[model samples]
Target: MIEVKGLSKRFGDIRAVRDVSFSVEKGEIFGFLGPNGVGKTTSIQMMCGLLTPDSGTIMIDGKELNPDSTEVRRKIGFVPQETALYPDLSATENLRFWGGLYGLKGDALNSRVEDVLRLVELTNRADDKIATYSGGMQKRVNLAAGVLHNPSLVFMDEPTAGVDPQGRFAILNIVRELAASGKAIIYTTHYMDEAQKLCDRIAIMDLGEILGMGSFEELRDQVGKGFQIFAKGDFDGPKLAHQLRKEYEGEVLHSGRGLLAVVVADATELGRFVAAMKAQGVNADDLKIKETDLETVFLKLTGRELRD
Candidate 1:
């Protein structure tokens, strides 16, 4: 339903997005995964016609996305990170207002508003003022407002940020329902678990460039076998680091006075690693092992952690 090629944008000397490209099918959830300030939102803005690209092309349903493409824009629904509803307005009022902006009216508009409210599981609180709702509830209504017109493709930019776990769970289900109904979804977030849970394919981006793109497992393979061992103690970092590089088929990811992290191919060698630490006479107050995750992938690709 959507295809982007060589998409790029710049703010003066800074390249906010560079040579980015990807595609999303009618029933697929395409994810833009990265940390903040990596241009995920800027790329989305260019695609949804909120911002013009400095270079490259954005095609939705075969036609180009430009200022004159009102019809193409109509096929998309964008739910931004922040709530766009009026504080004094109830959910029904908020959705009706947004629906009217889409030129929806009469029984058709009313039916759609009700349908989306039910879809987000907010029908019971449909009449509550947005100000009276929790962050999660407001988010659900924000989602309802975005798709009230039944757009063919939806752009959800961190729809679950700052929401409680239950709220996040509900929003995820709503997204699944949207995809099950055959609407293409472009979901952008830094949350690994959410992307892993929802997206069929993910594009990992950093410094305005796409470092990797594939399913979760596929991206994991790109980094080879990775299991991180983090130890915090007084130890000879360079000494142990040297030993790791020479003896193990992995990299000493982080090594310093108080912390040492190593990514090993096989986790079964955990005992020997612990033994080696003891042989070095290190006393670790905190030590932990992490299996390969999106954070690990992000670190391997960008040389920075996800929260960084």
Candidate 2:
């Protein structure tokens, strides 16, 4: 229900986002992932009409969207990383206030408040002040406020950030239910496992660009369908890395710290790699094939491990 093309934004001398383009379909959860200061927030702000882009186009259900697309903004929901909630107010009170901002009023606002409190399983303590609630409970109330308008597309930035395990689980289930009901979602988080568990497709961004985008398998294949053998301790890491890079079909890198990684495509290639290492008089106390995961894919794409 949303499409963004060639989107870019700049601040003085720094360009926060550059030529970003992605789409979220109905009933799909699109994971917007990146390390800090990599344009994830800037991009989201433009899409939500909080910031205008310098170039490119944002389309909401086929119509062009802009900062003043008042009607279009009605179809969008934003769940910020920090809660815009009043601690003095109860959950029901907070929802009532925010729902009114979305043009919800009277019976419609009251009914939505009741429905969402139930949907997030917060009806039991809906009357308690938000300050008395746990962090998880507060987050649930924050979520309730965001979806009260029933927007067709939602942008959730680190919704599970800092929440306890139980709270995170509850929020994830709620996200699934929203998607199941045909709402498109743009979810951002530093947690790889959360992205793996919830997102239908993933986008990895770095340095204001999308380094990779696809399903887990598709992105993993970019690093080659392989095993990354990691070794530490005494060894000629740079020499071994150089030889492997020159002769092997996959990637090889020496971290300049005691670590060396060798990526081999399959069993036969792995065997040959092992033999080659032995032939080169390389011996290390630590050596084994590590499981290739989303981090591995990120490492291949960015030449560095993911760090928050």
Top TM-score model: 1
Query: What tens digits encode model 1's per-residue C-alpha lDDT throughout 6-47?
Result: 999999999999999888999899999999999999998998
lDDT of 1 at 158: 91
Q: Candidate 2 lDDT, tens digit per residue, 167-203? A: 9999999999989989999998878778878999999
Clashing pairs in 1: none
lDDT of each: 0.87, 0.84
Off by over 4 Å in 2: 232-237, 243-250, 253-258, 265-288
Off by over 4 Å in 1: 232-239, 246-260, 281-285
Each candidate structure's TM-score, on Cα atoms with residue i matched to residue i, is: 0.93, 0.88
Global fold similarity of model 1 (TM-score): 0.93
